[model samples]
Target: MTPTPVDIPTLLEISPQGGIEGRSRRYEKFLGDMDGVYRDEHAWQDAVGERGTDDLVYWVDDHRYQEGPGALIVGTSTLLPGRYGEEFAVTRGHLHAVADRAELYYCLSGRGVMLLETLDGQTSAIELTPGQAVDVPGHWIHRSVNVGDEPFVTLFCYAADAGQDYGVIAEAGGMKNLVIADGDGWALAPNPDHTGYRAD
Candidate 1:
């Protein structure tokens, strides 16, 4: 099949912190008929160390469904303890730029804010919880944080396919994301699954 073009901007979403101390309202949904499976905390944690010791541990779909010409499906575990038990994780934040693929984030559990920044001095923040799905549009620099007691788990659906999307990340700078190995372990700050994708 040919790759479909996506209006990535339409997918970027950000939730603001609310409820006095920003206590998030929980959201839920049943994936009874979804093609993906959910793995628990133990399995998620074990896989992290095996892959690269990720502090932002989460489960993933690997691949759920194809939306645009390219695609990505990710599932988070829960947020890690931050100040006063707020969940959070900080990656190379400024790295891994995509070429027109929309990045989608879903709050499976916990409450938190999605923080985004760019190398050019632009910044954006969003708060989200269960039952909400936010889209991180293409060509923007971004990252996320979990701010609730439960670990922050969300699904990431990529706009571009693995070969062209993750590849560039694997070949750049000093940091990278965690990916599955031959038997479900993670690689140590390994290169991205694919390369050469850039904003157009």
Candidate 2:
């Protein structure tokens, strides 16, 4: 049987937070009893308010396409600028269920940091700015923090089969480090709640 040629779109229009016209599903993270997921309990309380669920900390607009044996999942994460005590607004990162699936993150707008960590506790934080992109290695848990005044946005892409395992990060108490806003820049602080984290 002869296969028919398919035309791929050359251009995709992006919205402010990185949503592509008709190909986006928005997901949000709010402040609640995230104590089990964050290093700073005081900050979490302050940011989420005493009652919790007071704020929308961040959101992701996912645009995905499944093509035959593989799939392309693209997402734009927007972390709102605020403090969870000393920590900045961040995504509740996840690990790929496929274990060996790699991903790529491209800074679309705003400024922030990408926190990557392995299950064994090896961790690193990379600066995210306009025009910057980072490759996320396999078996790593990843999250993003917004340290700027405006919403920090990034476009990320990974394999469709690279299912997310957010429970791993929650069980580990978030990333090994937290991104906090300095006077005019940002600073990295150890996640006090992460017991397995070691200084590098």
lDDT of 1 by residue, 1-200 (tens): 65444323223222322111221123222222111111123443444435444333332223333444544443332334232111134222333344444567777666656664333334456777788877876655555554455556665556435223323332333123221222322122232332333443
Q: Which stretches in model 1 have alpha-carbon errors above 4 Å?
A: 1-59, 64-78, 83-87, 91-97, 162-200
Candidate 2 lDDT over residue span 71-161, tens digit each: 6877777788777666777777888888789999998888888888887777888998889999999988898887788888888889978
Q: Identify the candidate with maximal TM-score.
A: 2
Worst 10 residues of 1 by lDDT: 30-39
Model 1 TM-score on a 0 to 1 scale = 0.45
- Candidate 2, which segments miss by more than 4 Å at Cα? 1-11, 33-35, 50-54, 197-200
The lDDT values for all models are 0.40, 0.74
Q: Number of clashing residue pairs in every model?
A: 26, 2
